[model samples]
Target: MASPGAAAAPRRGHSPLLLAAALLLALAPSPTTAAGRGVARECTYTLRVKTSCASPAARTSDAVAVAFGDAYRNEAHAARLPTTSGSRALERCGTDTFRLSGP
Candidate 1:
């Protein structure tokens, strides 16, 4: 039986495992292509993306980014800038601003 004042904690070895995981993650490369040019970069710069329009077909399909970075594979949508015209054509798709300092 345990003592009344005694408390339990995780094993000390757990830290090493976590450190290893963090190291691996820091060294891992973001998913990209053979070109590696778009293999993602340290998200220190502000990517002000703008497009003329996005057809209805573009709604569900992958976005065609002309910027210099890896495609937003699974990043969350921050906001959508719809056109005042209220047509299929949109002024901007969406905006994602963040600091992604990683490979």
Candidate 2:
């Protein structure tokens, strides 16, 4: 027989599994977030003139250069320019002027 005035046992803390799951969720990266940790898409800048551009793909410089050539051609056509010519490089985004090559 049980005692009539006995107290109940204390509640236990959260389970280890639950805690681990929660920690994993908190540390997981969100798919919707933009990835800018490494190299980011930057606009190309030339001799104090900035142009809309992107860098060549890693380990595929030739292919990327060719792709950028097409892009530049399209841009020129849209701008009603006769032709476009320049070198590929990394530059800041949203910049309008091309930066000088050296100091």
Model 1 per-residue lDDT tens digits across residues 1-103: 7798988654553212111001112223434433356544432333343332332223322222222323554232224322234343322354323222333
- What's the lDDT for candidate 1? 0.32
What is the C-alpha lDDT profile of model 2 across 1-103, one tens digit per residue? 5588987654455221111001111122235444555532233323222333232222111211111122323221112111233533323222222221110
lDDT score at residue 100, model 2, on the 0-100 scale:
17
Candidate 1 local Cα displacement, residue 13, angstroms: 54
lDDT of each: 0.32, 0.25
lDDT of 2 at 88: 35
**Model 2, residue 12: displacement in angstroms?**
91
Best by lDDT: 1
Residue pairs with backbone overlap in model 1: 43-100
**Superposition error at 4 for model 1 (Å):** 90
At residue 51, candidate 2 shows an lDDT of 30
